[model samples]
Target: MDHGRPKPDLIIFDCDGVLVDSELLSCRCLSEVLAEFGLQLSVEQALELFLGRSTKAIEQYYRDLLGQALPDDFLARLRARVLETFAEALQPIPGAGAVLSKLQTPRCVASSSDLDRVSLSLDVTGLAPHFGDRLYTAQMVRHGKPAPDLFLHAAGRMQADPARTLVIEDSVSGVQAARAAGMMVWGFVGGAHYRARDGRAILSAAGADRVFAHMSDFWEA
Candidate 1:
């Protein structure tokens, strides 16, 4: 614990990269789908552009780049493919369950993914019972990560003072959102998606108060 700051009353967790190790899988699926549409993005490029963003971001990106809406079935196809892959490969972040089981602070998931997607992720990874109905998604708010809206909404719902809240996230946008919400934020770089990246530096630059590479170091960091 960082003795300087008050202990958090509530811990807000980001679902995709932070809770479930689904970032790489998601980006890869996205790349494949986009390629079918003649959009040639590698998994790395997809992660660079859409990590921590919602499906709305995908729609906007398609429109911005092609000057037209994505094919009407784009989201449906993407969702089906991603979910199919997730069912076969998704796993909770290492130590996530152990940490959650022992954590004393009140916590909930706040994700940029859609409600159905986030819910399914938790369910598939055996993290659903830990959160129950406490999952909050971008679809619930007008803005998602990097906007402060989602975090603020979660804090309000959890009745936690933002200044005393701690957010565990893995994306730059998520770190920025937590800071913008006036909360303490820790960047987690344990997911497979971060294998070759300097996540500590990237997240620190995005205003995370602390950055750690594994959930085993969560409290110690």
Candidate 2:
């Protein structure tokens, strides 16, 4: 179909699963925290419930699971653990660097994760130089993914036309947010979150223009 010709002026990438292989890190972090409460959660369960959500949502999940609020230091401890884990292993997705280097248009990263986590992930993956000051964290926006606020805020900051922007995402909520912001949506299916039938179907039904199984397949579309 020669889908490469109609290139957009800006490309927004999700940070976790799209740029770095942090889905497992996320699952492990959550599992470890929940396990301290005597609750066991599988990676698959964590991926299904927690991927693409904010830290607050995750904290609340823990609170709900334990029937009590997490300690005030819970977030800080979790952040430290996740940062330490990611620092040791923040491998970039294959072909991501090549694709970023080849992109002629302006590019930025808009992630549902907080600024600190986003910065750490990008830095560890060596993608920090490519993004520069173009990193937009969802915490700055009124709402997170599935709300379109974050994507719209990012487009505004970049001064890029939403209609001419392309968003690469791995979560159904992220895809829905991009579509709501009037941008072309490309679903990246190489993440743990989309491993299930329902997750895959949800993304497709959310109106992703295309789904990519790998970064190499992204150029094909």
**Candidate 2 segments exceeding 4 Å error:** 1-6, 61-67, 192-202
Cα lDDT for residue 155, model 2? 92
Error of 1 at 122 (Å): 1.1
Q: Per-residue lDDT of 1-221 in model 2, one digit per residue for the tens?
A: 13553678889999998998898888889789768766688878887777777787776676777677776777787788899999987788777888888777899999988899999998988888889989998789877888898898999999998988999988878898898999988878776455554545667787888877677776674
TM-score of each: 0.97, 0.89
The local distance difference test score of each candidate is 0.91, 0.82
Give Cα distance to truth, residue 170, candidate 2, Å: 0.1
Looking at model 2, report the run of 10 residues with the lowest lDDT sum. Answer: 191-200
Give candidate 1 regions above 4 Å deviation.
none
Error of 2 at 171 (Å): 0.3
- Which tens-of-lDDT digit does each residue in 110-159 have in candidate 1? 99998888988999999999988998989889987789999999999999
| Residue 197, candidate 1: C-alpha displacement in angstroms | 0.8
